[model samples]
Target: MKNILVLCTGNSCRSQMAHGYLNTFSQGKAKIYSAGIETHGLNPGAVSIMKEDHIDISNHTSNHVDEYENIDFDYIITVCDHANENCPYIPSKNAVRLHHNFFDPSKVVGSDSEIHNAFLKARNEIRSYFQAFVNEKL
Candidate 1:
């Protein structure tokens, strides 16, 4: 099975959403992990959005990348520009790296519907991207 790591500035939003979608898409074909340079805890907005799509990420933790140094990952994906720019060197020698700056819905300030739509947009984009990743890579 492929071991995948998704990284971000905070393992709170985009990275978390990507992790959830990748896990659901992989369907046990891959071991998906997500972390950040710093843990800001899981974003409730992210969780709520994933839950709407039936992928529960509420149980996922906000972890620091240092905690995963021991594992040999097959892929390391940075889900935001901040993470892609600041990602530390992980010793997973064979890991393929990928990056996509998914929009942060949590940063949107608007009405409830607009906020929900922002999360939905991010969630859909994440779902689409990971679905392609699994199809082509996993």
Candidate 2:
């Protein structure tokens, strides 16, 4: 199976959402992993929002990129600008790197509806992007 890594500033929201969508889109044809420059812990909003879309990421953990230093990844994807800009070197000889800055729902400070909308928007964008990634690249 092809191995993919989704990286972000934190292992909390955008990366986690992308991980979920990528896993679904790849349909067992790929192995998916996600990590952060710093572990911010899995965001609750991410879990809830994913659940709304019938994906479960509540069991996912916030991980540091250093934890996967030994695995040779096929593709390394950064889901946010911060992670893309500041990402540490990963020693994957042939890994194809990709970057897309998904909106951070956790940063949307407002009423409940606004927060929910933010998460939903990010989730939808992630789904669309990864589906295309799987179709084109995986």
Candidate 3:
């Protein structure tokens, strides 16, 4: 099975969503993990948004990239520009690196409906991207 790592500035939102979608899409064909340049705990918005799509990430923890240094990953995907630009080097001999700057829904400051929409938008985009990733690469 392929081991995949999704990276983000904070493992709170976007990467968490991607991890959930990829896990669903891969269907035990691949192992999915997510971490951040810095841990910010799981975002409640992310958990709630994913629950809408029937993916639970509430039990997921915000991990630092350094925690998985010993595991050999097949793919390293950065879901935000900050992580792509600033992520620490992981010693993987054959990991393929990919990047996509997903919008940060946690940064949205507005009404409840607007905030929910933002999270929904990010979740959908992540779902679409990882669906393609699994179809083509997993």
- lDDT (Cα atoms) of all candidates against the true structure: 0.93, 0.94, 0.95
Candidate 2 vs 3: which has more lDDT: 3
Q: What is the lDDT of residue 14 in candidate 3?
A: 96
- Winner on TM-score between 1 and 2 is 2
Model 3, position 73, has a per-residue lDDT of 94
TM-score of each: 0.97, 0.98, 0.99
Candidate 2's displacement at residue 11, Å, is 0.6
Per-residue lDDT, model 3, residue 22, is 92
- lDDT of residue 69 for candidate 1: 97
What is the TM-score of candidate 3? 0.99
- The window of 10 residues in a row where model 1 has the poorest summed lDDT is 18-27
Off by over 4 Å in 1: none
**What's the true lDDT of residue 53 in model 2?**
88
Candidate 3 displacement at residue 28 in angstroms: 0.5
| Clashes in predicted model 3 | 0
lDDT of 1 by residue, 3-118 (tens): 99999998999999989988888989999899999999989889898888888889999999999999999999999899899999999989999998999898999999999999
How good is model 1 by TM-score?
0.97
lDDT of 3 by residue, 1-138 (tens): 999999999899999999999989999999889999999999999999999999999999999999999989999999999999999999988999999999999999999999999999999999999999999997
In model 1, the Cα lDDT at residue 115 comes to 98
